[model samples]
Each structure stands twice: as C-alpha cells, then as structure tokens.
Target chain A: MSERAKTPLIELHGLTKTYGAGDAAFQALKGIDLTIQQGEFVAIMGPSGSGKSTLMNVLGCLDAPTTGSYRYQGIAVGSLDTDQRSLLRRYALGFVFQGFNLLARTSSLENVELPLLYRGDSRKERHRKAVAALTSVGLATKLDSRPSELSGGQQQRVAIARAIVTEPGTLFADEPTGNLDSVTTRDIMELLTRLNQDRGITVLMVTHDDHVAATARRTVLIKDGLIESDLVRT
Target chain B: MIWNAFSIALREIGRNLTRAFLTVLGIFIGVAAIITMVTLGQGATLAVKAQISNLGNNLLTLRPGTGFGSRAASAGVPSFTQKDAETIGEQISGIAAVAPVRTASQSTIYLDNARACAVTGTTPVYFGINKWRLAEGRFFNDADLRSGAAVCVIGDTVRKELFGGEDPVGARIRIGRASCEVIGLLAAKGQAGMGDQDDTIIMPLSTLRRRLIGKTSSHDINQISISAQDGMDSNALINDITSLMRQRRGLGDNQDDNFNIFDTRQIAETLGATTQLMTMLLAAVAAVSLLVGGIGIMNIMLVSVTERTREIGIRLAIGATAREVLLQFLVEAVTLSGVGGILGIVLAFGLCAGLAHLIQVPFNFNLRINLIAFHFAAAVGVVFGYTPARRAARLDPIDALRHE
Candidate 1:
C-alpha cells in the first residue's frame, strides 16, 4: 500500500488541446508535461486567455486532450470512451464551480446528495452521508434551506459538501471563492485546507488571487497557453 | 436509474406548475375532443338502429312509381286497385297480411278546435302490418269495410292536439264535408327518421273514396303494405310480389313494371351504413387534433431543454451519465402528457353526458376508446420527446457550464 501511494496520482505527457480546424484553428494548451502526487494541494494561476482553465478541464477528465496522453492513477484516460471517462469521474473526481452551481429551489441537503444519487446510493445512506458532509462544513442547521435562501458563503459550503459527499479522491475547484467576500473566502480556504490535512484528499484549485494561491503547498502559473513557472513553498 | 430520473422529472415539473399546465393544454383539448366526438357518434348510430327497428319487422311497401323521389316515373302511371292487394296476399308464399291504402291531408274539426291532419284510408290489416297497437277502443271490422261506414281511428298526436285530455273514442269529428265517428286511439310511437308516426287518422278505404274524397272509381287505391311471416326472408317475398303484380298488370316480358316495391330491411341497412360512415369521418378528424397536440409537446420540450442547459451541465460535471440526462427529460415529457390525458378523459365524460342529453341521444361510456386515447397520448410524448432529450444529452459539459 505504501509503494502504491508513492506512484503519481496524475501524469500528463506532451498534452495539447486545439479548437476548430484549418486556418480558424486555435490551440489552448501547447505541449505540457506535469505530474501530481497523492494528497497534494496544488494551485493553478494564470492571466486571462492563458491555458490554465483548459489544463484544469483536461486534468479533471471533463475534456480530452487532442494530442498526447493523460493517465489518472496509472489508468489511461485518453483511450477511454465518454461513458468510461464519466465513470472515472464518478468514482474518483469532484468539481466546484465559481457560481456555486447548486440546483435552484432544492434544499441544501438534497444538493449535497446529488452526486451520491448518481452513484446509486440508497435513500438512507445518501441522507446520512449528506448530513455528515454538511455538518463537517459547519452547516448542520442549514440542511433544509435552498441556495437562494442562503448567503454566498453558505452556498459555497453546500457546494463543498456536495463535492466531498461522494468521497472522491480529488476535488477540482474553479474559482470557488470568486463570488464571495474576503472573510468568506478565508473561511472557505480554511475549510479546504483542513479537508486536505485531515482526509488526505488532493485539491486542484484555479485562482487569480495570489493570497488564495498562498494557501496551497505548490503553485503552477501559465502564460500564452504554456507553463511559465512551477514554485514550491517550504 | 430510471426511478431516479422519474423523481427528478417530477421535481422539475413541480417547480413550475403553471408552465407545465400551459404546456399540456393542447394535449388536453385534443384528447377531450376525440373522446366526446366518438362517444356521441356511437350513441347516435344506436339510436338510429333502434328507431328503424321500431318501424316493423319484415315489412315491405309497394307504391305506384319506379321509386320514391321520382315524380316523373309516376306521372302517367295508373294507381293500383284493392284487387291487386288481394292478389299479393293470395299468391305470395311468405305473405302474412296485405292492406290497400289511400291517403289525403284534410282539415279536421271537432267543436271549435280545428287542425290539418293526415287522413289515411285502409282496412284493419294495415294496423297489424305497421305494428301499431290501440290505446283505446277497437279497430275496423269486415262489416264496416263492406258497408263503407264513416268511422275512424285517431292517432295519439291527433288526439292530443284536437281532443286535449278528453277521450276521442265514441265522438264525432268532421272530416272535410263529412262527419266521421272515432272508434279507436292508436298508441304513441314517438319520433322516427321520417317524421312523427302518431299524427294521422285511419278509416276504411271505401269510406275515404266514396264519402270524403267523392271519387267513385274503385281503382283509386295508391299503396299496398305487405308483411312477411316471422323469420322469413324479405327478398324472396318481394320477388314473388313483383311477379304477381306484373302478371296482373298485363306487362310484356321485357317491359318494366310501372310500380316499385321497397323492402324495409334494406332501407334500415342503408341508413345504418350511412350513419356509421359519418361517425368514422368525425373520429378521424378528431384524431388529427391529437397529432397536433403531440407537436405542441415537442415544442415545449425543446424549450425546456434549452432553458435547462446549465442544469444539465451541473449534473454532467457531478458524474451523471448522458443516458441518465436523456432519461430525465424524456420522463418529464411523458409525465406531462399522461396527466393531460387523464384530465381530458374526465372532461370528455362530463361534456358527452351533457351533450347527449341536450341532443336526446344515449350517453355511451366506452372504456376501450379511453384506454386507447391514454396510450396514444403517452406514445406521442415518446416520439416527440426524443429529439429534445437527445439534444440535451449530447451537450458538451464545458460549453454548457459556461452557458448563460
């Protein structure tokens, strides 16, 4: 088990993504090679029009790289079909959007249970796990409140509960605190950091703020569809 | 997976109930219209059959013309005499009874009350041939016909109009310039396809010709009604009557007979076929509206798919398969139409019962048609829902998530 844990959780070799065809073709990612280990909290930072978002999509298995290979836990993701990739995401991946993306008019508990529903969990099991997830996010009393009724910070907590309820090994957050205030952003960051430390769940986050990136142990920055630098905090 | 999709669909529909109701309005109207039209049409067909059967069993009528609605054929045709009726009864093998008839419209008066009534002149056999029964008094006897007595039997309608509640039997009523004694009252037959059957008065043939019509000619009889024996085929009886009538009229082998014989059973079959054809035509038209309703479902489902693109993105990102997404939308569409079909069935029953009462036809509750309509509505949902569901399922998650 210790040797298996030493192997990289994610590995990409010469990955590239191109949109459209012929003269109108535009390249989003150009020849990127990267590896992420298990239980790593990494931040991806880039300016507008950089390849950071595309890299995040490819790494999350939401989009396939046009040229080259991507392996998640040594399983070749590039060769898998759309449904197979979906299965991979179902068992191993979770996502949090900048908009919270919680279903409107649904209670927070139901929102957290959405991923488990797709996993075919029983009603009792889903309810128990959803309650535990919400409680871990300090939202034990807001179980029945809908997204519209909750504050922005509370909505993000509900989204985080939904992400973790599936017990996925990796969580991809695309600007999860972009819509929240400074104090609420600090609260969400602390919650994410605590999850990484306690549960050993790897987190890949994309952010424009340096202060947000400072919360992670490692940072990778992109410019003009290419990686510019990779830095490690001691 | 399917059960989950169904619950998700139900939740989505419950979120916007007004929109859901409006979306299914077309299907509701279509189903209701189809059921109402078919139910009423079947009721009318049954009513027609009932009324025709009421005319008589195994009855035939011979008139001095090629057929009805042909005045030109009968223009120079000589009318039949009482001897012709006797020949048919004596020669035909399946004969039950035969009666010679002559009729005229005359102004009848009793005291100060006066009204125009059909005055028919025939023997007592005419009542038995037409299946008319007496409500009061007696029919004409052979002695009354032989002596040309001025006695009459009144129908229910004439008794109601001219006699009010008073009994017309044993009373004298003036017919044209002659006074006739009423001896019997015919029972009510209500309304038939031809018209009111209980609005005429009957007298002996000799009395109508000698006293009322003042026509001394014995060959003035215009109609001969013949009834066949029970369980007898009418076509053979008509052929026998035709041969006998031709032999008596002294017609050549190739010459057409100057008269027409009508089998009542054939008339009933023709009338029944016509009504059934009309019913099918109305039902087909109602089915077209049901198709249009399916198109309405497709249109609304397409709109829903487009509006919920972001929701689809979220589900996909959270590990829902494209098949699951497709199933979700498809279930929603079917649920909407299924509910509409049920509501339409309820509405159709109320409307059909009310309309049947107003038009005086029986209300028929046909379960087979209701079930067929409900199943068809659900099928429409599947056929129209596939395109929109496929569209939603095939959406790119990255692009969908960015959609406004």
Candidate 2:
C-alpha cells in the first residue's frame, strides 16, 4: 500500500480500446485502471477474447488507446506522436514476443544489439553491452550463431538478451514461453524469475497458464473486457 | 546513424545476393546499351572526320560540275585550261599553291607484267598541295614540269600490283606511246570514302596533255587543285575563284556557275555534323532502355518490400524510426542499381572495343557519357526506390507482424 505514494513506473486511467466503426465496432478494453510500480513482477492472465493482449499492447506503447491516458514515469504517452512513442520504446521499454522474432540470417550478437542500435549507440558500446547481456543469459559462446542454428530455448534466451541489452526499466513478455516444450518452459520461467529478483527489473508478463502466473509476485485476472480480480502474493 | 543503416542494408543485400543481381540486370543492360551506342557512334564520327581531313590539308578542288553531288565526269560542263589555272594562281590573294590536273584510264604498264591503270597528270604543286609523301626516291622537280619529262610517281596500290615488293624506282613503264621512268613511290594512305587515293600513278600535266589526250589546240585540263595559306579565309578565296571563272567564261549574272568548288575542310565539317546527328539519334534510342530498366528496379523493389513485411514489423517493434527503415531499404536499392551501373560500364567498354575492332573504327571512350550513365543509374535507383521504401515505412507494425 505504501507503494501508492511513490511515483509509479506506468499508469493507465479509464483506458479503452475499440476496433472498427459503427455497428461493426468491437470494444476490446473498457474503463481499465492499472498501475505498476518500479521493480514489480506482475502477471496478467485471462481466457481468449478477454482483452488481456490489448491491455498489454497499450502498456507496451505498441498501440494507442482509443480513449484513455497512459503515462510513463509521469509523462503522458498518449499525447506522443508515433516517432516519439518509438523513441520511448527504444529507450525505456523492452518487449519479448511469443515467437522469438530475431532477424533471420543474423548472428545472435547482432540480434541482441538491435535495441541499442536504434538508440544510436556506438558500435563498441553496442558490442560490449550485447556481450554482457548474452553472458548474463549464459549464452556467451553462441554470439555468432544465428537464430536458425539455435534451439527454441536458446533462441528465446537470445531474445531475452536483446530485450535487456539496453537495460530497459520495464520488460513486457507476451507468452514468452508459448512455443517451448514443458522443460524449456520451466527453464525460461526460472530465468525470468531470476532476472526480476536479482536485477529488480519491472516485469509484466501476459500468460493464460496458472502455473506461469504463480511465478509472478502479483496476479491480475481479466474477464470479458474488465479486470475481474487483482491479487498479491506473499 | 547513417553508417548503421548502410551496414544493415549491405547485410540484407548480401543475404539475397543472387536475387539482387538478377533484379538489377535490366539496369545493367540499359546502361551498357546507351554507353556502347554512344561510344561507337562517336568513334565512327571521329574516323570519318579523320579520313576527310586526310584527303588534303587546306585544299580545294575546282571541277567542271554544277550544283552539289554532281559528278566531274558528266558532260556539257567545259573543262579548264592551264591558262585558267595560272590566272587563278597569279590573281588570288590567298592561293598558296595551284596544280592543273588531267586524268586518263587504260594506261598500259609493263614492269615484269602489264596492267591497265588510272594515271593522274599534274605539276610538282600537286604533291605540295595534296601533302603526298614519298616512300622511296625523289619527286619530280621544276625541271620535269618545264621540260615535260616522262617521269612518274607510283602509288602504293600500283606499286603492290606491278612491282610486287620490289623497288620500282628507276624502272621504266610505258603509257600509250610514251615511256615513263618511275622516279618515286607514294606512301600508303589506305581507303577513303570517295575512292582509293593511293591506286593511281602521278605524272607531269604537260606530258599527259600531249601524250595521252593529244590536245594540240589548247592546254586543256580536267580540274585544278588549290591550297589556301594557313589561317586564311578559304570561303573568300572560293568566291574570288568563282567570280574569276565566271568572268573568264563570259557568263553574265545569275547564269549559274558551271564549275564546282569542293573545300576539303567544308566537306569534313558537313560530314562531321551528319555523324553527330546520327550519334544523338542512337543515344536517344538507347536512353529508352534505361527508362525500361528504371521501371524494372521499381518493380523488384516493390516485390522486395512486400516480401520483407515481417522484417519491417520487427524493425518497427524494435524502435527503429520509420525514416530509418525507409532509409535502409532505399540504401539497399541504390546499392543494387549502383553495382549494376559499374558492371554496365565495364561491359560497354568491352563491347565497344570488340565492335569497333570488327568494324574498323576508332574506339573513343567518352568519359562524360560514362559518368552520366553511371550517375543516372544511381538516380534511377533513388527515384524508383522511393515508393517501396515509403510503403515499407508506412506499414502498420501490428499488421506487418501478423503477415506471413
């Protein structure tokens, strides 16, 4: 409760998202109010058609809400243009998609350096930071290996390295282990948990699996287009 | 930032090297065609100008003909006499040298074998005006012109035909009832557009008038060759000679001069202008292919943008500005076409050299045209690449990520 007095990392007020127009319009989110503090591990869980993905997109700055105010570190995100939003995403945010979207035919080191490259980092800085990130993920020997040459778990690890290469304030993982086998999923979940606890990085993961949600310190459940329950674990 | 984009673009192109090369093939052919045509056309023009200039330096031929394209052999026009030539030589202000000439065919020559050949009769001034060089022995002096000596200078072709690699100097050959000594041999001048200038024999004008034509009444001559001094206005000299001939022939104003004055420089200029026109026409036609090649680049770039939609989405999601993405793809397009331009230049030079050799023309490399073609190809890459790059930049990241 004391966390509410401090400035939050992200805030959404009455956030609403809609698709199409007129009679064909569908509202994906309605009157959503959410807040995330620094160094918090939160999991958003929902069934299909429950608008959880839409909420994640807005939070990640990947999409703009139809009628809402989004603030990142107290700056209004909804007022920003596309390029401005991209700049925010480049500097302050990191995303891990379900499909480990590493550029094909590119070395893992190059994939990890992508975010820093957009920030106009020097080549030497980019290489140093990317190597450190890969080393943190225990993939130092696979720097030159391309995504095609790596296993599914290794590819996801490279994606994680890329996400953290910029030392982003927040990591948004949408079904990061959705394509992995049970063993690989467990290994990835353990890695995510270690990153959140050791580095104190704010992690917001969207998953339907209750077990995956259990690893997060807080669980948010959504039903229909609204948050049904919010629970904090000890 | 630009270096980053450039490196990315180079890597992407390297990833699909074969496709990139194939895509630029049209541009390659287009540039090569334009350069090859222009280079060869210029070479041919230069060759023609060289041949025309080789006919004579500052020379003009006065023949018995009316209007342009009239043959000197055509009847009805009166022939000029030695007295007329002497009058022009003494009266014209810029006349450097003048020679009255008489030509005759069917001269029987015997030098181990006899062959009928065309023989030209002229004074020592003919050698000076025409700039004919002696390969061996000495030319006819003033003594030969005054005494009407039966001495002749054999051309390269006549020497080859009759002498057969042997020195024909001091050898005696018979022309009709006259026996002439071969005092000199003229150097080879190769073939000219008009005819082979090196296939005839040269003798004294007086000797031919007396021995060949048997003109006992007057010193009748076929034509007169005149040379103007360097830096002199030949047109004024030509006008002066025209009025002189008209007055001598007793013709009134507007009677149409019966004699044709052919200036070698003027003929060269006219021929040069015609060849220049031909070169322009060829270049224009070849430029059409460059346009087609530009269209080809546009088509391939569009297809590439569509094919790389997922890649674009990834870039966008990773915080790459739309401008950066656009620049990356544009750089790739430019690299492809720029390489094509280089390859085209190489091919054009090789092809131009081979063709020029085959056709016996000079191979003139036009650096300006090559640079223009190269830069134009790069510009084509930019113009044609803009649409696809914009399309890729404007793509919705969400939709692009969803694209297969």
Candidate 3:
C-alpha cells in the first residue's frame, strides 16, 4: 500500500457523547470507534435518532466528544482550542448541511467566496477562486443569482461550491440531498462522486437512503448510538 | 480584518435599512439636542457681553439704593445731587467723566404718533462715559447744557416709531409736556438689561430738570455714571468715590453709606456665568437621552442577534472564529451610532443657526463640543453593544444551527 493509503485522515477511538445531566442525562453516542482513510468516499447510514447526526457533528469538529479521543491526521482534535479548531475547519474541512445554508439576499459568487474570505485571501483571489469553483460545479453562468432566486437543486449546488471553494482536504455532507427530489438527489450524488474520484477529495456523508449509501465505496451502518455493521462495496 | 468586519457590518445595515434607521434615531435626537442647547447658550452669553461692553469699560454707577438686584427702586435712600457728581469729577484724580442722570418715563408725541419711552437727563459727558456715537447731526454741547436748550437725541427705536423713514434729526418731538427739537440720532445698541437701550431719549440734565419736571433746583439726581481714566485702578477710584459720597452725606464710619455702587462689567460676567450654568444643565439633561439612546441600541442589537442566530451559526461553520463574530457585531453597533452622530451634527448646525438668527444672537460653531458629542455617541454604542455581541460570540454552533 502507498503511504497515503497507510495513513488515516480521521481516527475516532471509543468516542462517546451525552447531553444534559442528573436524571435528564441521555447518551447520544455510545463509544463509537471509526476510521476513514485519505482519498476514500465513506457513508454513515442510520435510522432516525440513531445518533448519525451527532456523529457527523463530532466528525465535522462542530462538537467535542464527551469521552475518548478524536484525531484528525494524527492530531488530537479534542485538545485543540476553539480558535484552533476553527482554523482546522477553515483549512482542512468543509461542511454541507441538509437545509443548504446560504446567506440570504447574497449572490452565489459572494456566497461561495465566504470561506476564502475567512482564509484572509485577497478580494481578487477570492473572486477568481470562487469563479473557478462555481465553474467546476457547472454554475459559472449563475454567479449573480441569489439563493432565493434559485431552485432547490441550484441552491444546493451553490452550497457545494461554497464548501469546496477553500479546497479543503475533506468534505462532510449531512443529508445534503435530503430536501431534493429523487432526480435531483441522483444528480447531487453524481457530483459528489465526481469530486471524490476526479479531485481525490475525501468525502464523509451521512444518509439514511440506501441509494445514497450505494454511491460510496465503504458504508458504516449505525444503530442504537453504536456501529452495527461495516461493509465494503466490492 | 478590520475591512472585512466593516464590510459585513455595512452589508447587514444596508440589508435592514429601515430598522437600522429607526434604531439610530434615538442617538440622532440626543446628539442634536445637546449640541443645539450648548451652541445657542454660548451665542446668548456672547451677545450679552457685547451689549454690556457697549456701556463702556471701567464704568461705575452710583444709584440711590442699599439693596441687592435692581438698583431702580431707591425709594428709601436719598438721591445724590449734581454737586456731588461735580465734586467727584474735580476731586478724584483718576476720574474720566461723571454724568448725573435723572430718569423719568413719559409718553413722547410726534404729530399723531405717541410712544412710551424713557427720558434720561444728563450732561454731554454722559455720551463719553457710555461711549455712544451719533448716527446723524451732532450731540448736545456745553452751550446746550448751560442754556437749558430744548434739544434731544432720539434712539433708533424712537426714531423708527415716530419718524418712520423720515429723518428725525432736524424735526421736533414732544417730550412729556415740553416740545424738544431732535438735534441728533443715537446709533442702534439693541437690547440691554431688562429693556431696550436704543428706545430711550437722551437730553441735557438742565433742560430735562427745568422743562419736563418743572423743577428749578438742580440738587436732585437719580444716579451718577462715572468712567475711570485709561490704565487707572477701578477699585481705587470706587474707594475714592465711596468715601467722598459718605463724607458729603455726613455719614459716620459705623453707619451705612446709604448708596449703591456697581460695575456694569461685573454684571455682564454674572449674566455670562448664569447662562453657562444653565447651558451645562440643559446639556446634562440631553446627555440622559444619549444614555437612553444607548439602551435603545442595545435593545435592537439584542433582537438582531436573536433573529440572525442561524446566520451566526452559518458563519461559525464557515470557519469564522468567535472573536471575528464578536468584532462583526461590535462594528455594526459603532457604525450605527457614528452615522447617527454625523447626521445629528448636521441637524444641530441647521437648527442652531436658525434659532440664533431668530433670537438675534451670533451663531457659534463649537467644534470641541461637537466632536465630544460624536465620540461619546460612538462610545455609547460600544458600551451598550457589548453584551449582545458577547451573546452572539458565545453561542454554540450546533445549537445555533438548530435554532429556528
């Protein structure tokens, strides 16, 4: 195996998360141990309230695990401060939500330029990079269109462009096509697959749909706050 | 980073233009009120000083009164004589001029026009003591005073009311029961003290005592106006006059002088101080509105933060640090108040100018007060904006994202 294949991009050991305390305490994640390799497309599948969203939040560095260790590229993520985690998210991670979170009344070009703005990129560079990213997603002609003016599929495409604008190493999509129709869902999944294969960007998506899970090379099924099955497509 | 924050703030404020304007209105009114009060107050104080200066420098007035406030009510005290004024002018070394004044109110008539005005009887030295100038013809001379000439100098108000556009210098006007020729016109001096100085008529003390009052004796005078020579110590001159008056009145050392001596310059200073105190109080009251304006800003900002919780979450997810979010909201607050400050200044300038013109006072541009008010408004923004900004910065990304 090559060195890139030998090293995992994300490693979670005995990770657990709980909410509230003293009689109202409830465990959302019960000691999950998962690993995702570089340049791999992985899908996390689970039913409603099976802790898949909580796990996705943890992997995206949006939340800290209550117990155990989470490492991104061999560095302990839980030990990092909020600012450091923010930097990590800025440089190494991207997120796409189910609701397609784009700023209202802003052009798609400016929306896509947000991540680059946080990176302290010059305005010209941000514009150039944002255009290139939008073009790669076949949205070069819709740069000036606002999310409210666009369709559901188009808004999601803009969200994806925003996510990948900074060229982070990994993309985390939590039910990215949840709000789309079946035809648009297939289109979005195809785009994710193309990004994974052509750009070699690692993609970790959480979905309950088997059809969405089928697009990934590896699948991990979560039940009762723990991994019940792990499968390889081949 | 500053530019980035500023742009975001600009965009957010622009997006909600109406709400933003309404939110800043409180600051606008507060700043305008403070600046208007202070500027107009300063103008009023300056106007009063200028009018008092028209009474001339190093001037002392001896009135027949022993009480505080107005010296017009001298019923209990004995009036000074013309001899007393002449004695001071001759015996006092630093005396520049001493004019004995005997005042009486009369309705002067000219043709069919009649107006109530003050008729002041004094010598030619009264013009020099008051530094009054003639607008037309010439002032009464010693010949006029000695001969008891029936001549008078009409003020601007009297000239306007009685003569209309016609020149009153060579015309005749009735003073009380005596018909006097208008020999000269006193230049306009506007208003002073409790009445208009330009509305009075000045005449020779001998002419007024004989013709108007029908009094043959020249011993009775209402007051004495004394002017000290240039470079003379006014206090020493006052001391000299006080002792001379006491001796003339035969008052013992233990007895009161039975008279009043006052400085017109000190009166102007006192008026200035009173107006200054009032301006400060008005400004302080207006500053409370600024504090209330700050509270309004805080209230609106808190609502804005809550309304944009999801937006904050989105920003956090896009790698913006909590400090960045904090800075963004703080910049927004400062921008709101800063713009309001500028607008208030413009409004105040217009309002104060209009008010000063209406009240016949000069418009004073006080840059120090304007800048202080502007910066203070901005500071209010920061202080009141802190809590909401901190609340925004401390929000958990997950919970914020989940917010409806």
Question: Which one is best on lDDT?
Answer: 3
Backbone clashes in candidate 3 total 0
Each model's lDDT: 0.90, 0.88, 0.91
**For candidate 2, what is the DockQ?**
0.66
Worst 10 residues of 3 chain A by lDDT: A1-10
Among all candidates shown, the one with the greatest TM-score: 3
Instruction: Report the number of the highest-DockQ candidate.
Output: 3
Sort by lDDT, top down from the best: 3, 1, 2
Ten contiguous residues with the weakest lDDT in model 2 chain B: B67-76
TM-score of chain B of each: 0.91, 0.94, 0.93
- Model 1, residue pairs in steric clash: none
Show where candidate 1 strays beyond 4 Å: A2-4, B70-72, B133-153, B165-172, B177-187, B203-215
The parts of candidate 2 lying over 4 Å away from their true place are A1-5, B70-73, B107-115, B174-177, B216-219
Model 1 per-residue lDDT at A90: 85
What would the per-residue lDDT of candidate 3 be over residues B1-404, giving only the tens digit for each residue?
98898888898898789989988999999999999999998998899888898887778999877755754455667888989999999999987889999998988999989999999999998998998999999999999999999999989999999999999988999989999999999998877875888898999988998899877555579889999888888778878889999999899989876887888877888999998898899999999998899899999999999999999999999899999999999999999999988999999999999999999889979999999999999999999988999999999888998888
> Could you tell which candidate, 2 or 3, scores higher by lDDT?
3
Could you give me the TM-score of model 3 versus the true structure?
Answer: 0.95
| Candidate 1 global CA lDDT score | 0.90
